[model samples]
Target: MSHIRLLVPLLITAGILIGGNGLQGTFISLRASQEGFSTSLIGLVGAGYNVGFAIGCIYVSRMLRAIGHIRTFSAMAAIAAASSLAMLLVIEPTFWFFMRLLAGLCFACLFATVESWLNASVTNANRARTLSLYRLVDLGSVTAAQYLIPGVGIGGFQLFAIISMALTLSLVPISLADRSSPAAPEAIRFNVRKLWNISPLATVGCIVVGLTNASFRSLGPIYGQEIGLSVTEIASFMSAGIIGGVVLQYPLGLYSDKLDRRVIILVATLGATLAALYLAIFAGGDEWRNLAGIFVFGAFAMPLYSLCSAHANDHAGDGEHALVSAGMLFFWSIGAIIGPLFASVMLDLFGPGALFTYTAVVMVAFMGYTGLRMSARPGVPTAARHGRFRSLLRTSAFFNKLAGDGKNGDQR
Candidate 1:
C-alpha cells in the first residue's frame, strides 16, 4: 500500500509520456506519408530518432548524477514538449528528422529517470508486482493513445498540440509530488563483444527484433495508408498488433522458463516469420485480414526482447545482469537505427506489401541463426537459471533492474 502510494505520481507521469510518445510515433509516419514525403525520407526520420535514443542512453546517467532526477526529468520533459510543437511549426522532412532526434533523446532521458527512481523505491519482495503494475500502465496507455489519431484526425496541427499538451502535463505529476529522487545510475558501457560471447543467441535475438519490430512500428502506418486504410482502420491496425502483444507474453515466458530458452526463441521467430509472410503475401488491403495477420505478428514478436534478456541473464556472471541488460539494449538500438531505412527503401521499390516482406526476411534469417546456435551450444540447466521470466519493455536499462535480484544493482 505504501509502495503504491509512493509510485502513483511516477506511474501517472509515465502513462502521460508514453501515451504522447505512442501517438506521436504513429502520427508522424502517417503525416509524413500524407505530406507526400518519400518513403526513404520517412524512414530517415525514424532512424534519426533511434540514433538520438542511442546517444541518450550513453549520456543521460551522467546528467542524472550531476543534477539529480527531478531536475533531469523536468528539463527533458520541457524539451520534449517543445520538440513536439516544433514539428507542428515546421513540416519539412529535414526539420522533422532533427526534431524527432531531439524528442528521442529527451524521452530516453525521461524514461531512464523515472525507471531508476522506481527501482530505488521497491524492495525485492514486491519488485515483481511493482513491475507488473508498471507494465499494465504501459500497455493501457500506449494502446489507448493509438485511438487519438483517428479521434483527433491526422491532417492538421491539433494532434501535435495534444501531444505537446500531454507531454507538458506529464511534468505536473513529478514536479508536484513530494517524493525525493533516487541516486544516479551508472553510465552505460557497451561491451558488445563481451555480451555476444556471453550469449550469442540473445545478442542476435535483440538485433533481429530491432530490425523487424522497429521497422514495423515506424513504417506500418505508412503501409496502411498506402493500401487505402481509413484513418480509423489504421489506428485499429496498429492497436490490434499492440494488444495482441500482451496475449502471448506470459504464456511464452512461462514456457521459455521450463524448456531450453533457445527452443522458445526459435518457436517465436518461426511464428513471427510466418505471420509476416502472411501479411506480405496474403492479407492485401482487406481490413480484417490485415488486422489478424498483424495481431499474430505482434503476438510472436513483442516478447522476444524479454525472452532474449532472460536467456542472456541465464549466462551472465555474478553481478553482471545489469551490464548484460544494458548491452542488449545497445545492440537493439543499433538494429533499430538501420532497420527503418532499409524497410522504407524496400517499400519504395516494391509496394506497401514489401514492409512485411522485409520483416519476414529478417525473421527467417533470425530463425535460421537460432537453429544454428542451438546446434552449437547447449541450454542452461533449469536449476541454474537466475531468475523467473518477467516481461520487459525496451525503455531504459534501469527497467531490467526492477525485475532482477537487486544484488547486481547494489553492486553497481
Candidate 2:
C-alpha cells in the first residue's frame, strides 16, 4: 500500500476515536438530567468513568501484551459499543454508573491503542507534527460535538448509540490496515511512594492537575445549571474551556521547555489560581463573562498535567519514562476519583461557585508548594529547546521501529 493510502485509514481512525470521546463531554450530564438524576448521582457517573479509566490503564497494557494491538483494540471497541447501547435500555443511576465505567474502560483501551500506534508510526522528523495533528483532530472533533447536543436532544439515547457506533467503526481501519503494532512497555509496577521519592514536585503536580481536571469535567455542568445557563449554553461554555486548553498548550509548552520546568509549573499554577479566583468571585450572573472565565481557567489549568508529565519524563532515566508516566497516571486517577466527591460536597454546602473557589484554593497551595520545592532543590538544567513537537517528529523512526517490534514480540 502507498504511504499516502496508509495515512487515510489512520486519520479516519483518529477522527472516529476523537469524535466518539468528545460526545461524552457534552451528552453525559444532559442525559442524566433527562433521566432525573440528582447532582450527587451525576457526580458519581463522572467518577465512575475516571475510575474505570484508571483501571483500564493499569491492565490494558497487559492485555495488549497478551493479544497484540489489533485484537485488543477491536475487542475494546465492541465492549464500548455494547456498553453504550446498553445505556438505552437501563436508565437507572446505578446502571448508568456501570455503563459509564464500562465505557471508560473501553475508552482507555482505545486511547492506548491509538496513541501507541501514532507514537510507533511517525518518523522522528514528523513525530511532533503527527502528535500535534492528533491533538488538533481531538480538539476539533470535541468542539464539533458540542454543537451536536441541540440536534440530538437530552432525551435521545440514540446519541449514545451513535457514539458507540463511532467507537466500533474505529476498529475497521486498524483491523484492515497494514501498519505494525506498537511496542507496549514492560510491566513495571508503578508505586506512588517510589514516584514521590524521585520527583516530589512532579508527583504533587499530577495530583493537583488530576483533581482540578476531574472536578471540572464532572461538575462543570452542575455548576452551569446552578448558574442558570441553558443546556446548549453549557455545552458551549465547556467547549470553550476545552478549546482554550487545545489552543494554549503548544505555546505554553514551548515556553516551559525554555527554562526550569518547575518554574514554568509554578507560574502556571499561580496563573490558574488567579483565573479561578476571578471566576469564583467576579463571574456574577453574566453567562458570557463566566464562559470567558472558564476559558482562561482552562488555558492555565488544563495544560498543567501535560507539563508535569513532560517534567517528570525530563528527570527520569530512559528506562523510567514509562514508569513515570504510569505513576503520573495513577496519581491523576486517584485525584480524579476524589475530586468530584469533594467538589460536589463543597457545591452542596457553599453553593455552585464554591467549585471554582475550591479549585483556586488548591491552585494557590500547589503554587506555594512548587515555589518552596524549587527554592529548596534546584535540579539540572532541562533541554533548552522550545517544544517537544519538533523532537517528536525527529524521532518518528524510533516509534515506527517500536511499533514493528511490538508486532513481532511481546513488549512485556
lDDT of 2: 0.73
lDDT computed for candidate 1: 0.89
Model 2 spans with C-alpha error above 4 angstroms: 1-5, 178-185, 383-412
The per-model lDDT (C-alpha) reads 0.89, 0.73
Please, what are the lDDT tens digits per residue for candidate 2 over residues 172-211?
Answer: 8877877677776456476767788768888888888778
Q: Cα deviation in Å at residue 212, candidate 2?
A: 0.8
Q: What is the lDDT of residue 88 in candidate 1?
A: 82
The parts of candidate 1 lying over 4 Å away from their true place are: 410-412
Residues 344-407, candidate 1, lDDT per residue (tens digit)?
A: 9999999999999999889889988888988899889989888777788899989888866587
Alpha-carbon TM-score of each model against the true structure: 0.97, 0.89
Clash number by candidate, in order:
0, 16
